[model samples]
Target: MIKLKGIVAAVATVSALGSSAVFAQDVEKVIEARQSFMQLYSFNLGLVGEMAKGNTEYDPEIAASAAQNLLALAKMNNSQMWPEGSSKADAGLDEMTRALPEMWSTFPKVLEKQDALTSALENFATVAGKDLDSLRGGMKAVGDGCKGCHTDFRAKKEEG
Candidate 1:
């Protein structure tokens, strides 16, 4: 009877370890997805930023296309990419993400910031194709929207 009990205990431990491994994989996937999404945001934003700075020629058609892509990306449903245990504070995820614990803890504040970004992007999309002057005028609000969220929720980058 004692041997049987020991075997059962070992099985349970193995099961627990398996579950933990699966959870870690899930967190990693979520972190990767969110990171990819941010990269998409940056890619689109860079196109417009370059034009605004005159680093790239401002083509109205390309500016409009990029701005529209940014708007679409901002509006994507990405809630699944932010599962509860995927933050930097989670075990094994510290190096996988720069998301602060407060992003989840502060709740509605994050939502508010998200709303601000969506609104700014919508405004940007409307005027982006109009002219260089209009694009320059709208860029500040879009930048501020991004900054507001990063300031409140993202961890400061570690200088390598």
Candidate 2:
């Protein structure tokens, strides 16, 4: 009976370890997904930013498309990708993510920032296709919305 009880205990321990490993993998996937999402934002924003800066020719159609894409991405429901244990402060995540713990701890403040970005994107989309001057006029608010969130919720990149 004692041997049987010891075997059951060992099985439980193994099961617990297996679950922990799975959880860690899930967190890693979430972090990767989050990074990919941010990259998409950067790609779309860069399209409009370059035109606004006159570094790229301001093609109205492309500007409109990129602005629309940015708005669409901003409106996506990506809550699952930001699960609580996925911040850089969590074990094994420091090297994989730059998300600050304050993002979760500060709660609805992040949501407010997201709303601000969405609002800016909505306005930018309206003017982005019109002309270079219109795009330039609306760009600062959109950029500020992004910067505000990053300033509060993201950690600085490590200097390596």
What's model 2's lDDT at 131? 98
Q: Which candidate leads in TM-score? A: 1
Candidate 2 global CA lDDT score: 0.95
Instruction: For each candidate, give its TM-score against the true structure.
Output: 0.92, 0.91
TM-score of 1: 0.92
For model 1, the superposed segments whose C-alpha errors exceed 4 Å read 1-9
Tens-digit lDDT track for model 1 on 40-140?
98999999999999999999999999999989988998988888877788787778799988889988789899999999999999999999999999999
Error of 2 at 84 (Å): 0.9
